[model samples]
Target: MDEFLEKVFEAAFKRESEQDENIVRSLPFFVAALGLVLAIFSQVVVRMPPVGTIASAFLYVLFGSATAIFSNILWCLFQLVRARDFKLPPNEERLLEWADSLQKFHKTGKRTRKAAEELAIVDVRRRLVEAYAEAAVDNRKSNRHKFKYRAQGFMGLVLLMVLASASVGVIFFDKTWRISHGQGATAEAAFPPPHREKRIDRTVRDGEAQASGAGSAD
Candidate 1:
């Protein structure tokens, strides 16, 4: 019975330790998601011009939504990584208490020393079991909280990516609409092409002047 109890506490401790390591390993993925959010915001939102027809107006709405989603994602990732009450190994105070109990058991009279040693051992085991149980419960709670935030952040990242793609499509659609409607002609009209007639006249005048100057030299 005692051996089984020990195994249970040991398993709980090991499981929580593994969970803590996993949370650390998963942090890089959260950071990568953050970078993706920034990349999409800059490429699809910040650089896009404000001038457009209906598509541009729709894109503006998407940009606003994306911005808000990314902000929330940032908050979620921050919560996931932020420091919290993670129960570590048994502290010095507990270890010293165990040692003091053992010393008292040894100092007892020789007749009771053997029994005292057994009781001390059981006491130490009980303390260890309590520590493991407490740490496991608290650490599991912390892990659950972190995982929840991470899940939220990951979903937000997926949504932002979709919005970015949609925004790109909207931009392309607006450009196509402008071209089909000849809305881009205004810029061409504003900067009219140079006169070919004026160029030809200048060329002729230069040729005549060059011929006259060469003839005089001859």
Candidate 2:
């Protein structure tokens, strides 16, 4: 009964540990998502025009930054490999060897057999524990094989945003500028007469010219 209870408690503890591990592994992605939203609001939805243009640069920067974050994540996969097959520390190996020596007996054969089976179980648990720890590392980061795809995802979203903004600007402001130009033309059409005299008229006919010249010279 005591042995059964011990096994039950061990199983329960293992389950909880697994849950904690998964949460830890997922934290990076959660942080990335949170930053994404904050960045969008800060760089986008909150305002418009001149400032937005300046902020668009940030979209590109964010993608590059996210890639950098993911690259570090790839390095973590190596840690997982290390945990799985890499030699255990001295104390751990000694303990594991002791367990392996115990697995040689069958329960029906002798007391030693029971101890051996227990040892085997312990070895299995050891391997699983290593795997669990390795898996607990954050997965939101990108390895070299997966990096191109993540970069594409970030850049694609930014490009789409830029296009959407441009489309909206053309929709909203293009007509307004056109209307303003039209009104300016109409105002010029109604402008008052010339600011200065365009000509000074001097008219002289053949007979009138002859009389004017006869009096002028004398």
Candidate 3:
């Protein structure tokens, strides 16, 4: 039972060596930074939002973060998959082996550093250099567009916002023109107030003359 428990603990909360932990943490961070920039460039911002602005803003942040994290994950996965296709570089492996050899030489003080140097390690590095002479094809940068995996939804939303902005501009223009025309109509209507006053004055004078003539006849 104790052995089983120990195995379970190892599976659940296994501790990574310090070097491995550093590499794991740093690699994710470095890879994520790339996606962060890509996501930022890909995102669109909205301004002068309507009544539901706060709610919409919150939704935007939520979706945006999810997209950025997903993108980061995708980027990390891509790198891992690509690296898997290529066997561990001989140079990298040899470099590690050479360090181990140096440590062993130091521990066994009887052995000279020259005797500790492995010819196979030198040959490994040499083979790596000769095999890829002047041709270092970094697949990530070279086949960047090969994935054909785009955030279509994100781009669609960006274009939709642009169209919406143009639509709003058109609406505002129409309303402004309508208000100006309405004001002109009001001014025109007001211009004939003097004519109305003249008609009213003539009516009053005619009535007065009729009343005076009627009194004289009586």
RMSD for each of the candidates: 7.3, 18.1, 20.0
Q: Which lDDT tens digits does candidate 2 get at residues 118-216?
A: 767866566545544443333222132234433444454455445445444543463355367785354333432243122211233556787889999
Q: How high is the lDDT of residue 48 in model 2?
A: 31
Q: List model 1 lDDT by residue over 26-60, tens digit each.
A: 77886786687677667765435445446668878
- What 10-residue stretch in candidate 3 is worst by lDDT? 12-21
State how far residue 81 of model 2 sits from its true place (Å).
22
> In model 1, where do residues sit more than 4 Å from their true spots?
45-52, 92-97, 106-112, 185-218
Candidate 2 local distance difference test against the native:
0.47
Tens digit of lDDT per residue, candidate 3, span 119-177?
43454445445333322233232233323323332343444444444444544554356
Give the clash count for model 3: 0
- Check candidate 3 and list the clashing pairs: none
Say which candidate scores most in lDDT.
1
Q: Residue 215: error of model 2 in Å?
A: 72
Q: TM-score rank, highest first? A: 1, 2, 3
* RMSD value for candidate 1: 7.3
State TM-scores per candidate.
Answer: 0.74, 0.29, 0.26
